[model samples]
Structure formats: structure tokens, C-alpha cells
Target: MERSQPNYRLIYHDIISIKCPGKKEECSPILNKKEISILDVIKLNMIIFGINDKETQIFNQKHRSYDESTILEILDYQAKNNLNNTQLANHFKLSRNTVAKWKKHFKNKHLHPVKAN
Candidate 1:
């Protein structure tokens, strides 16, 4: 279901967060399943969303060096989905600048698999 407020719905997790006790500013953690650990929670999402396991691991993950393969992956997904920079950024929970940078990179070159040393 589409939400009027996207912040209220944890679409990726398929569960909404309540307020943390006494913490008005912060929402509570997700509780749709018994997650023994963070890794387990990621695994659950992977199965539930039917997406690549890597995407599940990094869906909310941010602030790390993006490799060429990952960049190409985003480029391909954007093209396939016909998503603009704003749409891609919102969908991926990334900054608009990041999406713009990637989009430019994609337009400027061909995505080729490279051997890592």
C-alpha cells in the first residue's frame, strides 16, 4: 500500500516502528520477527523481498566506498526501472547528489566487468 507519509512505513522491513519508550524523537526498532542479531534481520528481509542478498544487506547501509560493480548495479537498475535521479535517490534512501553522480557516471561510459587484483 502506498503511504501518505513514507517515513511512517518501513516498506523494506514490512513493519512499522512505534516510539521508543521515553524517546520521543526516535522510533522503536522493528519487531516483525525474532531477530537474534542484525545479520539475521538482514537475512529475513532478503527472503521476504525476493531481492539479491547483497541488496538486503545494503538497503539501509550507507557511507562506504562503492565499488564499480555496485555502481553498475545501480545504473542498470535505474535504467531498467526508468527512474530519474530524485526517484532513484528516494527509492534507495540515498542523497540526491549521490544519485546524480551515479547517473552521470552511467551516461558517460559502458559498464564492463573488471577483474580485481
Candidate 2:
């Protein structure tokens, strides 16, 4: 079994599982599901943004799928403006993973403002 780091439950899980007898295995399938698929994530994002079926277009012509590379710039822009992913996602009505995909694209160190000599 792959044990998650300590405090993972405290920090990440918002719901507590109430296991009942043999249902232990299925008690919290969301946790067991682990990785989320890209397509499902996109659909969730569309719903979050309220685009649904009404919107034919997704991304703008200037850019493509929120590719890993371009997402870095978006993350930096969000951080430089002192916005957390959750806040930005809520404000923009985007999914946390969609915002997180961009955040994961770049390590934080490189984004820091270089100090003048």
C-alpha cells in the first residue's frame, strides 16, 4: 500500500469517511480514484465556467489547449498579482486542477523576482 504523507488527510480531504463493515473498500472511492482524467477535467471546467452547451468555442484562437508550457505564464501572472489558485479559480469559475495544472508546470523558485546587485 502506498501511504500518503502525514497531514494529507488534514490538509486535502474536506470530507470524513464513515466506513460501514464491508463497504470499507468503497467508503471513499474518490480518494482511491487518485488521478483524474484530462477530458473529465475539461468538462468539469466548462461547467464551472458556466459555458456548458451554450458556448461553441472553448479557448481563444490566439492560444490552444491550456498546454503545460503556456500554463506556466498564467501561473506566474496569477502569483505576481498575489492570487492563490483557489481564489483565482473561484473568481474565474475554473476547476482547481485546471488552475493546478498550470501551477505544477513551473517550480516556484524560477518565478521569484531577481534581486538587483
Candidate 3:
């Protein structure tokens, strides 16, 4: 049986409050939210904290899933930036082997995109 896709929607409380000096302050529940893609989340992390080789190794220990669109975006970025497999892997904290496999897999799937398994 084929596996179902995972939910990538992430929600968090971004509460903003006002303070008063020695007076009963009034507060209201404000929901400030926006939908962000998982790829954007990963990009933000990389921007905020420059990932090192050790961190990349540790991150590689964890298994993460990416949809076809996301994979295509990554590969496109690699092409746009003129990055080799190793450089692209280091930038995204992915295994070089994984990058190579994705390149090979997608290249072969060009003619039969829907048949990628």
C-alpha cells in the first residue's frame, strides 16, 4: 500500500500584549498567524543558525520527508546557485549521497514524472 502524505501545517502562539504602570491592564487574545512552507522553515533555520559540519552530521541522523515539489525546488536552487552535489548537500544539511540519488532519480523521471516511486 502507498503511504499517505504528512501534514506540514505548523501553528504557534504569537501573543502580543501591552503593559501599564500600576494599573489593571487589559489584554486581548490576538491570533497572528500565517502559513509557511516546510522548505521556508528549513531556510529560516539555516539563515538564523549557520549549520556546521558537526550539526549537519547530527541532523542527518534524523529522518525527514520532502514532497516532490520541495525536492524540485531544492534541485532548482542547486542549479541556480551552480552548486555541486557536495556543496548543495552542505548548504541544505543533506547527505551528498542523498543529493546524488535525488538527481539521478529525478533525471530518470523526467519522461515519466508521475511514475516516480
Top candidate by lDDT:
3
Candidate 3 local accuracy as lDDT? 0.55
Across 1-117, the per-residue lDDT of candidate 3 in tens digits comes to 988543322221111112222221211111112444457545433443446687775865476677777777788778777788888888877888888888887874433232222
User: Candidate 2 at residue 116, lDDT?
Assistant: 17
Which candidate, 1 or 2, has the higher TM-score?
A: 1
- For each predicted model, how many residue pairs clash, with residues at least 3 apart or on different chains? 0, 0, 0
Write one digit per residue (lDDT tens) for candidate 1, span 1-117. 853323322443334223222332222244344332333344444444446566654755664445555567666667777777677667766777986676666665645422211
Q: Model 2 over residues 4-111: C-alpha lDDT tens digits?
A: 433422322332333233333433443345553333334333433435452444343123345443455555556666777777666555667777655554566346
Clashes of 3: 0
Best by TM-score: 3
**Quick one: ranking by lDDT, best first?**
3, 1, 2
C-alpha lDDT values of all predictions: 0.50, 0.46, 0.55
Candidate 3, TM-score vs. the true structure?
A: 0.54
RMSD for each of the candidates? 14.8, 14.3, 9.4
Weakest 10 consecutive residues of candidate 3 by summed lDDT:
24-33
Instruction: Estimate candidate 2's alpha-carbon lDDT, on a 0 to 1 scale.
Output: 0.46
State every prediction's TM-score relative to the real structure. 0.41, 0.35, 0.54
In model 1, state the lDDT of residue 33: 42
